[model samples]
Target chain A: MTKGTLYLIPVPLAEGAEHVSYTPFQLELIDHIKEYIVENEKTARKFLKAAGLKTPQQELRIHDYGKHVRDKVNYQELLAGALRGEDIGLMSEAGCPGVADPGAEVVFEAHKRGIKVVPLIGPSSILLALMASGFSGQNFSFIGYLPIDKGARSKKIKDLEQESQREKRTQLFIETPFRNNQLLSELLKSCKPQTRLCIACNLTAPDEYIRTQTIEKWRSETVDLHKKPCIFLLYAG
Target chain B: MTKGTLYLIPVPLAEGAEHVSYTPFQLELIDHIKEYIVENEKTARKFLKAAGLKTPQQELRIHDYGKHVRDKVNYQELLAGALRGEDIGLMSEAGCPGVADPGAEVVFEAHKRGIKVVPLIGPSSILLALMASGFSGQNFSFIGYLPIDKGARSKKIKDLEQESQREKRTQLFIETPFRNNQLLSELLKSCKPQTRLCIACNLTAPDEYIRTQTIEKWRSETVDLHKKPCIFLLYAG
Candidate 1:
């Protein structure tokens, strides 16, 4: 009979400005919360410092969230406290905590222990990029990042393009900060002329660019795509 | 040169409760925004009244959102103002507004008009479902919903499943509330035996369920998948 409540907090999407994804309305109730579990100790300290967040406000460093694949020990301890009626906030480095970040294991553990998991939307590049990309929203797929191998990566693009066409499902993917331009070149070379492509770069930041264009146009265009880290969405019509 | 910003506001995930995907950090600023936006109308009046949201504060016209959406003329006028740099909050009936929701149009239109589209994090069923599916979150897809036609929908599922398997990508989809069970049955019948399927129903709700099993297990077992809108994830591996 344990009911622990875990709040999955979404962090800022870009460097300076915050991304719109995690907007947990109840988060203003910082006083209601007594414990916070974060991916990194320093970040937890920094976030507390940055925002001046506090409950009883005592800092509790249980252990690294990475201590175990499941981190059952620390997880159970947190859940135990939560079951005794404690408010807990779980955080990761950036983006949404449980998506591509490190809160999945904690979320699962919390669930197994019958804890109520509440997600707060603040910032997520994936959903924002998908929305900004004029691709088909009716159906779409997000493959976090492309493979590193050039040949395999190109094959992946071909496969994704094919899937989008056959299924009428929009295909979305991301690349490393360094490999963005290279990925664009490959997309232009490999994707068909009619395919719809969108590049959402520096999302939420001052220099944000959500450029939606056809592969043909993108192939011939000269755009400052290198402005910042970006999300790539491709649709095969 | 208005420099209008786009706010991707998240509405509730369920009827009475607030959405979990929304982070509290962002909601703090929204409180400040209400003062500016509601020069004429109080935010508590406009936002809560429009969304039909009820609180200890006042009698909620939950049906107001329906009425608001139905009043096409009035709604478009609101859109006009938002497009003109009023910094309107893009909200939905529930969940993240822009992803698969009709509000995405404004985001796209905003980008076209050179306005800044800012996405704040909050409760999104899509990312939450993906995190719980136990599938590889690193590379996954969000295909919003399936078609109503049986033939076309079946074909779409087959194609997506094939791609998921071939590319080792996770295919995610959501269903209308009433059609959830039907969709689950169809998924069991259509997806291959080895394909790993996950069902996240009533996410963040009291009766929420996150079940992962093979197609065969899903088909052979008795599942009480009813009443709630659900997200389906089928992984290639």
Candidate 2:
């Protein structure tokens, strides 16, 4: 039998239950899959229900293989069904799967084993933030999360800012929900006044806020990004 | 009047008439948007018609601001409708707008003018290819297109591969449609035998082909990617 295809499905960025975030094509694809390897079973089930999956919860087989489930799980077992000609879906807690998440390892192993992988269109905070940031889309780097330590984190920011200036590229990074404001403050303090900064908060939520301005302009504004998922982009050139 | 929102819309990747590439939500948005800034007015019209846009052909306002029209047209006038509380949609010839396309300029100018930009969930070939490549998802750089000169192109490829090795990052780049085969041949001839390369061809189309293998294994395969839009990803680490 041919190896089963793996689908990299995307989830909504917001947590609201009423959010209709997926495309019809994506929803159609979700309804057809019976197996899923998700970051959180509860949220995955909720997302599936929202997508209007045809299969009942009792018939669906879901395996937890997210960041929380790492270390205890042998990933091979996750793809075992796929190897036996059963299509499997991979879902992240939010946004596109295998992107700044633990699903990359799964995708890596699937590629190594030569299984078919398909990615469905959905909201990606990173890409959406960058798209609205008005930065260099032609050349950019996603640096994921920065170091947490004060000194190390500050140094990394400086390095990334310098790289952005030198290469004329957009540098993207995310922060913990609570640390969003802290990172913004640090960015304003460390980067040059003329360096452009874009803060995209609650990307797809009803209260979405996406604004791009210079560090100087950001410093003057009264901003409160506490406990919100935010993407910070900087481009000096 | 309040400033209108800017929507970044996605177009079908192939020219096939039978392809239903958009989601229902996308179709709804397209139907409501009367103003569009597109890469190709003809193709954009065709796409809108297929997506069930309700606006008649004569009433739909499409202003072409692609690379070819860069110096020929003033873009600010295109968004005048949006600035007067009218929503404007931006569409590309294929794939998502403002991504690897000239729509970024319009998006950038919108940011400068403090306009709201909303990116609808749609197909993005770059993210799709990366998700399937099984390479480094946490740290990656998209270097749009390689230099056209033979020597510069080869050198750029080597530099990108070296950077990929040093950073454990996935390096992504594209080539002109006609140069697709030439770039693949160069990649096969230049990269190390163990380096991993994935070519995502005819993305989102029925003939979609996504395969990843070591340089050694790819050498044995016959590849003819002529006149096809393809994304090439390589990871040496």
Candidate 3:
């Protein structure tokens, strides 16, 4: 018997962001998937409802892969339904699954078991930030997050800046919402004066803000990034 | 007077792949724009028509940014409509604009001119490939095309493989459709037997193919990728 396919679904980056949209194909596919492996059960259920799932919430079978239970969950058990020829959906808290999220682990296991993996189209903050940054999209790197240590973070900033300059590649990274301001300040202090920096905050939201300017120019501006989801990109070339 | 917003739009990767879908918000926005800067006028018009454009095709103004005329076109002139307070869209031959395409130049100029740039949600082959590859997506680099010269290409492959192993980061790149097989063969020859490789071809299409296997396992299988659009990912970690 053939195993069921694993569908990778993406959720909105911001809650209540009405502008966040999904393709009809994605919605139709979601309607047929009653089983899921998700980062957070509550949010996933809410999203499924918003996406027009006809299946009743009580009837849905959800396997929690949330951070708190990540270590304890049996990934193979999550796919047991799929092995029995029942299609399963995999979702993250936000954005595309398996990109910069723990969802990749589930996807990795699916591939090992020879299960078909399908990634549906959806909003991705990383891709949107890179597109609007006006940086070199041809060659770019998403380094996830910087070291929390001040000294190490500063060194990483300089190293990424140097690499961007040497290779003409764009470097992208993010920080926890509350620490965004701290990261922004460190970036201004660690990067060269002429290196370009782009701060894309609240993407796809009603009050989205995206701007790219040189570090020297950014130093003169007064902006607060406290407690707002944001993606930072650097391009020295 | 405020400058008009520049919308970065995405087109389907394969022609007549009707399974490809877009957002309602995207369709609504496309209805309001009558001017576009596109890689190919023919395909752009076809996509717009299929996307439910209410305006007649003859009334729209298109700026040709196709490869044949890329060097001659004045990018500023393409944004003339936006500068004049009329929204304009930027599109590539396929996938997301400003990503691995000449659309970035236009987006860069938009930033310099303080034009608002918004990237709409849509299909992106690179992002989808990474999601389905089951490789490390927390950190990854898209190196674009490799050196076409045989020796340089092999050396670069080795270098990327080393970097992937060291950083536990996925490395993604593409080649002209015709050169895909050549690149695949080279990757198999240059990488270690344990390195993981993913071939994502004709993504989002009916016959979409995505598979990840170690170099040793791949050598035992027979597959053809002669002229198919494909993204190759390597992860030694």
lDDT of model 1, residue A5: 67
Candidate 2 chain B: worst 10 consecutive residues by lDDT?
B16-25
Supply DockQ values for each candidate: 0.32, 0.63, 0.75
Query: Per-residue lDDT of A65-172 in model 3, one digit per residue for the tens?
Result: 998998887868989998889999999988988888878778878888899999988878999999889999999999999998899999999999999999999999
User: What is the two-chain DockQ of model 3?
Assistant: 0.75
lDDT (C-alpha) at residue A82 in model 3: 89
Q: What is the per-residue lDDT of model 2 for residues A125-182, given as tens digits with 9 covering 90 to 100?
A: 8788877887888888998889999999999999999999888889998988888888
User: Can you tell me the DockQ of model 2?
Assistant: 0.63
- State candidate 3's TM-score: 0.97
Q: Mind giving the per-residue lDDT tens digits that candidate 1 earns over A95-191?
A: 6676766766666566556566665545677877776664566777777777888899889999989989997777777777777788899999998
Clashes of 1: 50
- Estimate TM-scores for all models: 0.74, 0.94, 0.97
Chain A TM-scores, all candidates? 0.86, 0.95, 0.96
CAPRI classification of candidate 3: medium
Backbone N/Cα/C clashes per model: 50, 0, 0
**Model 2: which docking level applies?**
medium
Model 1 achieves a DockQ score of 0.32
| Candidate 1 chain B, poorest ten consecutive residues by summed lDDT | B32-41
Q: What is the TM-score of chain B in candidate 2?
A: 0.94
